[model samples]
Target: MKEGPDIAQLGALIGDPARANMLTALMAGGALTASKLAAEAGVTVQTASSHLKKLESADLLIQRKQGRHRYFALADDDVGALLETMMGLAARRGLTRTRTGPKDPALRKARVCYNHLAGELGVALYDGLLASAMLDEVDGEPVLTEAGRERMMQFGIDLAALETQRRPLCRSCLDWSARRTHLAGSLGQTLLSRFESLGWARREAASRVVHFTERGETELLATFCRQDQNSHGNRSQRIMRDT
Candidate 1:
């Protein structure tokens, strides 16, 4: 018979606070160097390295070498999806709370998710797409509808070519801030790239926060009406007050 999964091993790896923080940082969808991760985890380099070794051994992370430096990222989207689910459960169980701080306004607007858009704008767009019958949720995955394909084609996405790729076309990634699912997968990445290509959004230097351009703001307002109306009004006001 096949061996059962090693529950204890998985549990032990994530049980450490430092390792948890490191994993969280990776979940933001970028490979980071040990030094950067160390700072993020609020630990010394030595301690972070030790934790990273453990996580790597657990098959939860992967490391790549670039010249002399080593960068670490999650093993795959599977790892990120698992972390997202865990975070969701944690929130449902009241094990964590939303962090409040002085954050960039643009970040609150939109940002990258591994390779796709995330944050309030991303989540709202996902919702709008579902509501508009552009996508359908099936067995935890988002499937593009016929209308979605046509719409994407008009938006300059080659739907047939995207399907030929090995990567998923549509996926749902949990949003850290909104605690909701956003678009992910190749389709998500394509949408983000298209937005950037159109000068709709730009990434902040040394941060994951994404800033929308004036043109982007107008385009998004015209495309996603609900988000446009809600973004700068009662919703933001409430978030500001609550935070």
Candidate 2:
């Protein structure tokens, strides 16, 4: 007899059209009420509640209570990653849904992946960090370099505080749209927060799209691209001296 984790069960749960819609709606990285999700799924509130319960039972969704209201969100980043990978595969195979919304272009440019950024901007950030030696590949995962730590601190990211968290400091997640890697894990989330705090970008309501002002994009490119050029040159000089 074969023995392994049951992928079939999970697939079945996600395969239902209504449930899929509900799950996709939660991908925006916000906890939503059942009524809101029901509208997204085009289902009745009672039906949405039942579907939510099933997802919660399957450990795909988590329930949060605030005051007198209950909201739902993706259980964790793993679930979000899996869904994004699936979407990427389907898109590549030409299995896209018939209708594309006006927000499609914006979504492909910059959108949220669970909490961190995903899309063209996301891939650019990952490449920038790698090219700059701010992040290094270690055992197939991203590890913050000494230079990365110092740079992040300069940007007001509290690396000391981040180290205290249970989650990993850095990770690389595959980008569905760009077919590249994007930063994930706690550090990724913190960076997104920093962008918002700086008034450089904001998440659109009812969507995963991250809208960056013209000034914001300019500042972002200035910060990251310059790091790439400077860090690479500095590292090369260090290597020459050591040799």
Candidate 3:
């Protein structure tokens, strides 16, 4: 007998096709009713209820009561992160869905992963910060430097408020479409919300795709890419001095 935690149990709960679909729908970072989830999984409401019960039992989901309705969402950011990582691995192995259409490109370019950004734009944001010395990967985790905090403040992010949260302020979430890392954690959530607040981007209805207007995309590039160029120039000068 394996003298440790039973991963098989959790695996089985998430392995079912119906359950997997339902969980995927919840990855939108919002609560969904059993009936809506049922539609997503192509199952009946009764069946979805059963699957929801199993997921809730495993602590993979949370059931919330609002008025007379019961809604379900991923238990926490951890569950969402795990699902994103699974998708990334599946993409790496070529285990992707065959249905491709116009929206596919948009999804690959900019999409939301739970509470944070993912896809091409998301990876760019991560890379931009790293190059600018606003973020660092230390001891296998992403950390925000002092200058990073100041930069975030300039971007209208409240660092002090973020520090008060129980959740991590910075985390790296693997992106499935881009096959790279993006920001996660509370700070990541704040950035996404801020973008929406500023009308820079908006999440599509019934979809994970994020649409950025021309102005929004311009602003995003102007804000992050300027720093990227400086970082590149600095590195080139250092190499010239050495060689």
Whose TM-score is greatest here? 3
Kindly indicate the candidate among 2 and 3 with the higher lDDT. 2
> What TM-score number comes out for model 1?
0.80
For model 1, give the RMSD to the true fold.
4.4
Per-residue CA lDDT of model 1 for 170-195, tens digit only, reads 98888766777788888888888888
| Each candidate structure's count of clashing pairs | 0, 0, 0
Q: In lDDT terms, how accurate is model 3?
A: 0.84
lDDT tens readout by residue for model 2, 211-239 = 98888777765676355346544542332
In order, the Cα lDDT scores of the candidates are 0.77, 0.85, 0.84
TM-scores, each model vs. reference = 0.80, 0.91, 0.92
lDDT of 3 at 144: 97
Candidate 2 — which pairs collide?
none
